[model samples]
Target: MFWASVGFVGCILISLGSNIVRKTVERILTAQVIIMWFILLICVFTLTSMNDWIKFFKSLVENFGKIPPDISWWTLASAVCFIGAGGISNIWYTFWIRDAGFGMGSLIGKIPGWRGKKTSIKLSGYLPKPTKENMRRVKSWISNLHKAFWLVFFLMNFLAISLFAVLSNVVLHRRNLVPSGFEIAVVQAEIFQSVAGRFGYFIFLFMIAMLLWGTQLSICEGIVRQLADTTYLVSRKVRKFVKRDIRKWYFYLFILFAVWGMVWIVLQEFFSELIKPDFFLFLSANIGLISQLISLVMLLYFQYFIARKYLPKRLWDIYKPHPIRTVILLLTACFWGYFVGMAWMEKLGLLS
Candidate 1:
């Protein structure tokens, strides 16, 4: 709790002073990802015996149906909802890119706060005219963004999850041990310590701290930026009051969020007792699933109707989402929609 508080306060301070928080987050997170990858490789090579790997695969094949049981539908649903929530949050990439002054975001300007006048926001909706050169540049920028997303987000998540599963199977499952509550982290660390001893335990602790710190910092900044951008985009009165200085609004929202978070932290146990933990999880998952479904629909609408209508004909080939991609998006929405419906029914006591 002490370290968590320190990390949280440090993130808030860094966010207050830094206008280029996205770049800072990228650098730090990239380092964390590298470290995690190194640890994962080390564990796979040194910790996991060949017999463990074979037994892990064999267990999956033979006892997969017995795992987690059919009664854990809520847990499975929550996991799905979390993934959907994560997918929806990816929309924030556009906001971050714009803030980072990449491509057309460069023209929109950025909120300068303590970073100085050079980073000040300028109010404009100007987009570059579609010339072959500009189109090529835009395409290149988008391609690079996709590559970065896949390498950093997809690859890292895949490897981390894979490592966890492998480690859990090899270390805990063999002993019929299941980690619960506070024991979760302790058990997970055993994966590393089993191979590298005390040094591995220290490395695991460092990795957790770095991951949480980076996540908190990025989330704090991103939420502030998104809230400020949305407010400015939606309300003329608010926009006039803030003028081109989005940093003012960002700071205001930051304080508001901080205060609210502190209140929640203080009252968390009270709230937890008032609303059973399972019910709270259900409520959160329901909201997240609904939001995710809505965002997915909106994304498709923008891609198909808005972009096709407003975007230049010449740039259509470069900007248009492929048919396969659109179908996949729709399918994902449908999948989440079904689960959300089931979750709601379960909440209403109509489904079990």
Candidate 2:
């Protein structure tokens, strides 16, 4: 508990410090390059041969969508949502990309630090005029976005997950070892230790620590940005309070978030017995179901209705929505909707 609190505070400080400059977040993420490389190396070395990977992929294909009898359907659904930004947390990418200065996001400024020279910011952004030069720039931006999405997001995460799956099959599956809770990570480290001795174990531990630290920092920053944006848009009181100084609202909300997290941690530590493990599982499942359903509707509506209604016709030719993505979103929404209905029926003893 002590170590967890200390780690939490340290990551919060990193998030706070990142607000100092618009590019500080990028720099902090860049620093993780070494750790990420280490993780990749460890995972790659553990797998060792192509046969190991081929067998893993074969088993995955064989067991695709076959849920274990012991595991609840809700648990599987939530796990899917938790993996690879599957919930409304996927919206965090919007804020991150804006902060990265993509498209019109370059015009709308970032969250300012408490102690920095404030940058001029606007609540809204502009559409680039559909001149030939501007059209060319938009084309280039779209191209770059596609490349980055595939290379940085899809490929990296796909490889990482695949490697981890292979590691589990090679190391734990044969031994009939299934790790849960805090031991999930510790047991996984045996994969590395089997290959590289005691050093591998510590390196694996460090990699896990770094990954969790990065995840927490990004979540904190993203949620603060999201809440700040939502409040500023909806509440006249918040808009009046912040006036032009949006930084004040952002920092205040961040502080409140930090306080709430700390309070929750304290409660978890001192009154642990009162917080049933199943409560967390239930909460996560509901979050996944609710967010997945709501966000899918909003995404489809914005893509088909809002964009066409609001965007300039000239830009429309250049900013066409992907039909495949729209179809996938609808399918995913239907899936979660059905899952949620079934879960509720089960709880009501109707499904039995």
lDDT of 1 by residue, 1-352 (tens): 4565566677667766665666656676678768866866776777687887687678778985453655455556677765412634566778878877778888887665556453435555666688879988989988988897887667767667666678777767777988765576677687668768988888776776666676666667667778887887677787677665666777778778776655655565567676454565556666777887899999888888887898778777788888888898889898888877776777678874
User: Model 2 over residues 110-184: C-alpha lDDT tens digits?
Assistant: 766766555545766799998999999998888888887788677877777787677667677877999877787
Give lDDT: candidate 1, residue 183.
72
The true-versus-predicted C-alpha distance at residue 252 of model 2, in Å, is 1.3
Show model 1 residue runs off by greater than 4 Å: 50-68, 83-87, 118-124, 190-195, 269-272, 275-282
**Best candidate, lDDT:** 2
lDDT for model 1: 0.71
RMSD of each: 3.2, 2.4
Q: Model 1: which ten-residue window has the lowest total lDDT?
A: 82-91
Q: Estimate the overall C-alpha local distance difference test score of candidate 2.
A: 0.74
Q: Report the number of clashing residue pairs per model.
A: 0, 0
C-alpha lDDT of residue 298 in model 1: 93
Q: Which stretches of candidate 2 lie over 4 Å from their true place?
A: 19-22, 190-195, 276-278, 347-349
